[model samples]
Target: MWWSLREKRRRKMSSTHLHSQRPKRTMAQKSMKNPRSRSRFSVKTSENYIERMPPEVILKILSYLDAGSLFCFGFVNKRFQELANNNAMWYRFYAGQQAKKKNPRLIDEVTDGLSVVGIQERPEGYWRKQFFKELAGYNANWKKKLKAIHLYTGLPSQTAQILRSLRVRWAVTLTDGKGRESTSEQTHVHFTDAAVTVSWSAGDWPFIDQLTVLKLHGVVRVPLQCPDEYKPGWKSLLTKVKLNKDVWKLCGSDRLVKLLYTEQGITVGVWQEQREIAFIMVNLHYHQLVERSLLGSCVVQYQPAEHTAAFDDVDPEYGLHGYAAHIELHSTAGSIASGRFSQLFCTKDQISDGHLQLKVISKSNRSQHAPLCGSISLPWRTDALQGQIEGCCMLTLTVFDEAQIPFWCVSAPVAMTTSEQAEVSYDCTGESFFVRYEDAEGKVEIELRWMEDHKQYFMVSLIIFLSISKVNKHFGRDYLPQ
Candidate 1:
């Protein structure tokens, strides 16, 4: 009886110890019990499950997305960023983008069949860099500005005559930012005199002055277009409809802001007090132009007059005798400037057979800032004007800026006279005659020398000296006391 009572007491003590060692509830058990906690827990597990997926499956899913979407997906996680930057995939994306360009080139065709193995072997991030480079250009807004200058309505009589008789030729070139040039296949615009009128603007924007705003009446030839490889840095050369759209500006030396409309493409030049003294038109045939070459040397061309002497049977007074005008462009080095001069346009009242004479006077030299040198000889059409000197004889030389747009016009007449157009002054030597025109805009001095051979007039040498002035002013309105 005493042993049984001791065993009962031990059992009671053991029961009490077991009661004190009871377990607490676990987190998993709590989550299972609560509905909101269960949903939150499941979401975390699902994200981890996706992260643990094989790279091949993840990449396959990403391949279905567009370039922009795939690029954004990289922000999700480190693993996703690695998958998104795959060079082979980006290469394909880039090729697809190329195909969407207005004038898609053969580049897309060549890349179409590229094997995965070949694309994979490219440098790390190579295709990604290329794609972003192209995208930077593509995403920017391409724009140009158009305005009409009263071509005929209000002008000086002399200026009116010049504008009425004005003729232009369009030429285009491609530039690679570096000093490289590619001229157009079709050098001249089909219609040289077609002006960019409000009609060309197509009623998109209100004209500043409709009465002064001329309308392009006739059917106009479409502007020239370039392939993708030859695309210009600016979109102005490509589309006409976008003229009214807001422009995206570029930074740097090649920065082009406003494009003034004339006949063909836009004209880039300096404006003073809301007046355009001179401008060079970007040839309608091309959208963009680059500096053709660096300047090397300046040159001088001279031919001495011939003296009729010795025993000659032929009469001194005879046959058709007219003069040919010669131009010489010199460089800082006193050597002839190399590369092609911008353009030469001559207008005369009495001479016949007026034509374009372009001669590359010197071979290109490896130099920088050398003005492009060229020679032009304008001779009277031998078909007309046999013997007498008639009316006004004028030669216009238009000088271009780095953009190949005419900024200054040097108009040199055959005869030296004080006229309403320009103040005429001359410095005459036994060999040559120098006529100079200077104003706030710039300075232009042209040298002309007459050469005589027998009874016939041989050649007129013209040397043009040009200088541009940079003038800046603070903006404010001047007021007069009432």
Candidate 2:
């Protein structure tokens, strides 16, 4: 019995020791499976985490940000600072923003820290004040680039002088005042001041293709030289002569002897008059030639209907008669040969009667003295033809002495048609006026009522006015006082 009790006690002690050691073995295996867990357990328990990405991808992201944001982000790291200093990146940004609008101040700020590759920094207020000064110093080592210059009217002469000193191969001046000439390539200058004179030597200004002198003083003389290619010939000659007062006297040339008037000399107004004379000459010559060519071959046809008379009420004040003539060419031949001819002349009394006579000649005949067609006399009185025709066709009316020597002519092509009529009516008190018109085809009628206060007229027409007129009319009505 004593030996059995000892054996039972020993078995119970061994079983308790095995149970205590089992928990320790399981914990050891879990720690070995996860090293990270063991490290976290050894340190403190926290959720703070930091991730690192490639520097290149980060830079690309930064590039999309604006200059201000990119500037601030540059301090994020050394890599970013390098990117921020890149000239190309900043240049692209500067060009893009500048294209959208002008912002010189913003450009200055962005390029302040970076070293620009090909461009140099201009001094402060360079564009506003010292732009030309800087441009003048820049050597002409660069290729010629076409540039347009916008000059202000009120700029001081010194500024203009500085601009003239620049290496501008070609320049276009946009101002009302006179511009100084540059010793460079051809320059085209436009001005609103009509009285401004452009004085340049023909040889020096060889590049000048066109010179337009706008409304100028009646007495100002512009010295112009014909180009070498356009030297005097049988066609026309260039003569340098002084214009006394308003009269332009051909002093140095004997060619204009026939065109000379009394001591008053030939004025510019006379040249304008000659244009009309030339047209009348063309018409008279054409009609005369046609009559001579077709005289025996074809019978003469006439539109004998009496035309309504039209008159300018102010003609007497201007010492001009309201007389005119209309002639049409119905050519059997397809084309008229081109050649120079003498001036067209008419009897001094032809104005009162509205009579026209054409000098006829054959193509084979080249003499200035040619046989004439029978006189064309229209019996229509001034009052009978009122509002009967379209606007007057361009008629060259030449008045000469009985000897047929050309004296004075007026060419005013009236843009009138046979089927249309124009009538201008004035109020008795001269306070209001209106115009009525009928189209040549008689398909349309229009009436325009004058609004004296606004200095405008309202037209009732078949066509529509553009959108601008609608806005203008709306504003005009709104602004008119009740």
Candidate 3:
């Protein structure tokens, strides 16, 4: 009996100890489930989750975020700020923002981030001081984001430094409009303080080309030894100045050939003497001529060559003079001589000097008595007629055939004498006849005559009279008879 009681007591005690240990284990697990009780584990879990994501994927997600979001994220920790400030990363971000919209806040954020990372090693206040100094030097408005800059007096070091730091590519313009008045003034300066050095990684400058650099100023300095792919946009600034063969040979044989002929469309052959220097003007189609690369090489060879002969005779006046005429006579008959009549008159000053004489040899086999009639018109103007030379008026002769068909004519109008006598004679067929004249008005008159004493039928002629006066000073000479 005593042994049984002892064994039961021992079993109960052992069971009670095991139950107490189970409660302790359950309480420990409940404490772990509560977050406040497991702060260290929660931190470890968060770190592992972040570490699982790739840095590039994180950056991509950050790129889609706005500047404000990035700024907020930057304050999350030092690691985030460093990621936000990476040059390649931010460069793309800033470029995208600038392309989409002109946001001052975005620029400010970018500049601020850049300034922070750029001068982190400097003194505490050194960056601020330098920032203001550069700001003043650039005359840049921090409040307003910059789109373009015009550096007239050469780019300053501070400005260049800021541009380089910002990875900003810019074009340059050099103008010579200041010294136009002074003849001895030098319009352009050979050297400028705004020298730039380009270090390219790609085979060629992709975003930058001849078209983009239309406004680049001064000569580009080529490195003594450079990569074969690296061309310096023509290092010499000898544009529009002719180059000698030796000088051109330095530009490469193929380049010289292209410069002389193919590029300019100028068929360059051997000349008597080499043209050391000549201004070359390129006549290209609109878009092609505007290209900076084409203009750079082409302007060196602009020489105003004399135009070659394209025609046999090119006169300044009476351009390409030739003549064609037709003659027909009708005298109570159908037609006399009508065929193609072409005549080219030589350039004669007499034709314009009120004295024109043209002889027509008939091609038609018709006899001369077949009522031959012809008319002649000059290519230029003739002199106007004046009246009464020493009480004798000048008259122009017109000849006609017996059938009253007019043949030859003169430029001068017939003028009759002032006498009322009806016996003034005009030699028609070498015969003298009487003609009558009357002065109806001052410097104006009329004349009449009868042919063959036929009283009922009268041969009438008219004239307008004029008198000569002292030459006006403005005219400076006597009147030329017309």
| TM-score of each model, in listed order | 0.27, 0.17, 0.18
lDDT of 3 by residue, 181-246 (tens): 110111211111222222111111111111111122123222213342332223212122222233
Off by over 4 Å in 1: 1-54, 71-81, 93-117, 128-464, 467-482
Residue-by-residue lDDT tens digits, candidate 1, 1-482: 99999999999999999888977668788788998987787675445676778999888998898766777677778888889889878898678657667454655574756677888888877787677546544222221111222232111123222222222112233233333433332211211121111101111222211112111111112111333342222211221212221221111011211223332223222222432212222322111110010011111112224322233233322211121222223211121221223333221221222211222121122131122222221111112121211221223334443223333333222232222343232422123334443434444343333333332221222223222112111111111111
- Please report how far candidate 3 places residue 60 from its true position, in Å: 32
Q: Evaluated with lDDT, which candidate comes out highest?
A: 1
- Ten contiguous residues with the weakest lDDT in model 2: 275-284
The root-mean-square deviation over C-alpha atoms between each candidate and the true structure, in angstroms, is 22.3, 29.6, 33.5
lDDT of 3 at 158: 46
- Best by TM-score, which number? 1
Per-model C-alpha lDDT, please?
0.34, 0.27, 0.28
